[model samples]
Target chain A: MSEEIIIAGFGGQGVLSMGKILAYSGIMQDQEVSWMPSYGPEMRGGTANVTVILSDERISSPYLKVYDTAIILNQQSMDKFENTVKPDGILLYDPNGITHHPTRKDIKIYQIEGAKLAAEMDNKKIFNMIVLGAFLKIKPIVKLENVIKGLKKSLSERYHHLIPLNKEAIDTGMKHLKKFNIEKHIIHN
Target chain B: MAELKLMKGNEALAEAAIRAGVDAYFGYPITPQSEVIEYLMAERPEKRTGMVVLQAESEVAAINMVYGAASTGKKVMTSSSSPGISLKQEGISYMAGAELPAVIVNVVRGGPGLGTIQPSQADYFQSVKGGGHGDYKLYVLAPASVQEMSDFVADAFDIAFKYRTPVLILSDGLIGQMMEKVVLRDQVERITDEDLIKTHGSWATTGKTNRNRNIVTSLDLQSEKMEARVHRLQKKYKQMELEDLRYEKIDCDDAEYLIVAYGSSARISQKAVEIARKKGIKVGLLRPLTLFPFPKKQLFELADQVKGILSVELNSGQMVEDVQLSVEHKVPVEHFGRTGGIIHTPEEVLDALEQKIITHGHFRNHKTRESSIL
Candidate 1:
């Protein structure tokens, strides 16, 4: 199976790291994976994005204009990538600071209030892990054990103590994701 | 045993250089490629293999350091982006003149001047056409993947020492920054001083030990001597073209149209080929591994099989000239590019192929988007 995904949000939201962890999970399963981040000025406290591809066969490109899934974390990203998802593809987002919801009828849409959940959990940093967990719940492309291993690999040794908390956040994310009916979407000219 | 790990192209290349018995790396850090030096500095290859990693004051100083280290027959290398590479041109020319064996990496960024720190293939002409002024050619390797980025370190060093000329690993910021799974090779021990003296004693500047000094310089005052030196350099280049040319062909057996690309562009074009074939369009990709030896002969042969050829690059259109020259206009050759760090998508490449090659801009229904672009 080949899954091309784009994870996008404001720079500090761990958008890039979520993609990295996903890519690492793919590697743990011996699948070919590529993680390409947008490393321009936009990454500095502005909108940041990374294109992650997990494939059974050799991956052809790391940079893609369209994706099988778009994991959006902010209004800017939701506004931009909602249309880039392939028809019948998945659009997962966190409705924390988002104003405009996804408006595509051809693609499946889901929401996880990552920021609010992280605040309730009293650990703001696990917001991305929560979003990642939500994504895995829908796709299950990678096993949980592998995702844990990937999280360990992505984080430094000093932060290993936080894995359990991250794991909890991930579980919460999986439990809390809500899907949109996606009926009668308004078309923008 | 080969160990597999996910790594950025620049990091993988640096790790591979350490494993491949590199003696020293002298470089100045630049965006997109700074990780090469950063990884090397952090790994402390000196502790592991007695290799030296130094950050020079400037790009010029770094390249000169490479020239100095290589003159002593050491496995040496340096890396930089477009502007920094431009600053090192003089030193690169000096290395070429002295016939030094060293590996240089250009993780290219957009530029005529300090343009942008974004990935670009604009350096294609600068790399293959002798960026440094002189009668010399660097055996250029254009790596398309992180695996190749790791693997080509040893390959470039091999070509550098085998031919007694400098070799360049021509990469771009995209490949440099992208991370992927790469199988790391087992570490090879560095060449001992005794082995170094014995192997390169004939031409190296290892000091006058019980004999005449082995002088290393590119200077020959006599006109005929200079002519001979240039001819010898040319002969080496010819040998490289004959012996070590590298390329890859995908889905070309039944392809009606071909896309010629290298490095990261090849990866994108490969996807485009897959999409085109899925749509029942007979398309293929030709990826040139060695830019200097260039798959001209192979491209010429493919011209006979394919009805059209599209040269895809991240530049305004440098390699397109070479593509045209390769096929001698046997088939229609056109260029599609996205400069200033913009990468074209797979669909965009296919659309360009359709508009520019398949139809050849003849009998099209509308203005062809060229007017809109203009």
Candidate 2:
């Protein structure tokens, strides 16, 4: 199966690195993967996004107009990418800073208090890892072992000591997500 | 040998150059390609292999430094994006005229002027058709994948030294910035000074101890003498055309239509071919790996079998002219592209194939075809 995903947020929210770790996990599993970032001047403080494709076969274009899943970290990313998810696809978001919730009936929507949980854990850097954990909890396209290995491969040696904390954040995120039923929301609307 | 590692295209090229025993790297920083020099500097090839890495004041200075080092028979290289590459044209022409072996990488961006820093194949004419101010050809290699970006560095140097001409790795920002897994080769040793003297001793200006004085210049005042030199260069180019033509044909055995592209466009068109096939349309892709030697013969032969050809690029219409020239009106050739940093999607390419080449039967109207070719 091929999974195309987009993760978007502010510049320092680890959106790009989360995608990189996902791609590396795909590689560890001997799958074909590609990671492309929206680079350049916009990466300073503006919204930054990365497209990650994991496939059993060769991947074609690194850029995509639509994605099977979108992991949005903030309201701006949620506003931009909510509609880009394909029908029956997944839209996972951290609802901490989102003003408007997703209202699509054809796809699955899930929310995680990633930023709030990371703050409670006293480390804001694990926000992306928590969100990533929620994505895997819903999809499970890649094994958790592979993700740990990917983290080892992606992070430099000096950052190795933080892997356990990151792993704990991912587990917490996996348990903390609340599924949002779009059908119920649509009927209420 | 290094194990498989995920790397960006620019970093892969830099690592491959070090493993290929590049004697020196002289370049200026440019977006989408700065990692090439940055990686080299961080790795400190000077400490590891005694290789020289210098950041020049400008692209012109960097290319001229390459020219000087290549003249001494050392394996040297430089890289830049489109605008920076434009500044190195004069030096490139001088290198080509002097028949010096060097490698230049162009991580192309949107063009015409200082356009957007997005990936583009707009430099097709500049690279394959000879960008410099003279009648010289560069051995242009277009790499579609990060693996090719790494492997082609060594291959380009081999071809460059064999032909005694500059070779260009024509890539773009997409390949430069994206990350993929690459298997790096074992490190090779740089050629010793004695080996250089033994191989290029005749023409290289390495003290000229026993033989007559060696001179390297593109300037020959006499018209007839210059004409003779041009004829010799033409002969070399002819030889290259005969020996170095490289291309890849995908799913063409039963294809009724063909899409021609290179570099990043080729990757996208390959996907288009798959999508078209799934839709019951027989489409194929012809990707030119070596743009200079340009798989013209193969394209001509394919033209005899396919009903039509579509030249897809990321430019207004550059390589389309070459595609048209190759087919020689045997079948209708049309161009479809998105310029100014916009890359065409696979669905768009498939739509163009159906709209322009197949379903509409646009080739059936001879008058329309003639006008379109013009």
Q: Each model's C-alpha lDDT?
A: 0.91, 0.90
Using lDDT as the measure, which candidate wins?
1
lDDT of 1 by residue, B1-374 (tens): 99988899999999999999999999998888999999999999999999999999999999999999998888999999999999999998988999999999999998879889989999999999988887888899999999999999999998998889899999999999999999999999998657876765467877667767788898899999999999999999999999999999999999999999999999999999999999999999999999999989999999899888999999989999999899976777889989998889988999999988888634331343344357
Instruction: Please state the Cα-based DockQ of model 2 relative to the true two-chain complex.
Output: 0.68
Backbone atom clashes (below 3 Å) for every candidate = 0, 0
For each candidate in turn, the TM-score is 0.96, 0.96
Candidate that scores best on DockQ: 1
TM-score of chain B of each: 0.95, 0.96
Please identify model 1 stretches exceeding 4 Å from their true place. A182-189, B361-374
Scored against the native two-chain complex, candidate 1 gets a DockQ of: 0.78
